[model samples]
Target: MGNTDKFEMIANIYDTPERIQIAKVSSDAIRECLVDAKSKNAIDFGCGTGLVGMNLLNDFKSILFLDTSQNMINQIKQKISSSNIQNAATLCFDFEKDSLSDLHADYIFMAQVLLHINDVELVLSRLYEVLKESGHLLIVDFDKNEKIVSDMVHNGFDQIELTEIMTKIGYRDIQSKTFYTGSKIFMGHDASLFILDSQK
Candidate 1:
């Protein structure tokens, strides 16, 4: 199955109580990452079901929620509309190929989605192009030190590898932290959060 198909399948199962708890943990980490940012213009890349966007409402004045799956975007739209989150916009577009249309954001967030991309470096480059000077890019995904499961399609890199890639792409002050100490059977690994700011 393709990425979108796999995502769609998961979306059906993601609404369970346990999954909602995990999503809350992820969203909390994302909220902590944006606490220091002064800019209000932000983009939540791969914003599945609007979890990240919902948590980010206080930090950012406006948010553009971009995701590859139309289903995912629809889910986010539903949540936003029902909750009256007026400062957000949902876009169904592939992050790799879509043009940013002269938009420069102060912060770009990609949580739990970087590993699924085929080319990490290229994705970083694309994100960098649309980021304003000294903009921060917060990436939260599975750390390589964590064990892999059979169902997971894409594998993640270690902190060193991720930091190297960010540095090579002209990002500075790269910092990483592991959020969850314990692991569950289904998740297969403890998740990590990486925070990096673009160099001026």
Candidate 2:
């Protein structure tokens, strides 16, 4: 299956109520990162169903939601429409291959999206290019660990390795927070939230 097909296959399962709840928790964490920021323009990379955007709506003057999957963008559109979130735009684009010059934003968020990307450094470099100097990039994804072997198959990253990569790319004040998710019904994974400031 193609990359889009792989994501589409799990879109339905991810949109379920249970998964949405988990998304909300993740979104909350994202919001916390931007709580003190002064940026008004924001972009949600790989924005799925608008969960992260919804949480960050009030923090930014405008939010551009970009994703590789049309299905995912549709889901996000539905949520935005239902909530009447006016300051938002949805774009279909792949971060790995697409140029981000057309959509510059002060802050960029990629929740649970980086783990699925094969070239994390390339993605980070692109983000750095599109962001304004001193801009912030917040990434929330599953951290590398033995406890989440199954999840690692699809989405995973080594915290130390990723941190080194980000630092090499000129990111500063990089911090990662490790957390656990899931209860009895589902298997929880070790997730990490990374916040970095782009240096000029």
Off by over 4 Å in 2: 9-13, 35-39, 147-155, 184-200
User: What lDDT score belongs to each candidate, Candidate 1 first?
Assistant: 0.72, 0.71
Name the lDDT value of residue 43 in candidate 1.
Answer: 90
Range of the 10 consecutive residues with the lowest summed lDDT in candidate 1: 191-200
Best by TM-score: 1
Error of model 2, residue 175, in angstroms: 1.2
RMSD of each: 2.8, 3.1
TM value for model 1: 0.85
lDDT of model 2 at position 4: 67
What TM-score does each of the candidates earn?
0.85, 0.83
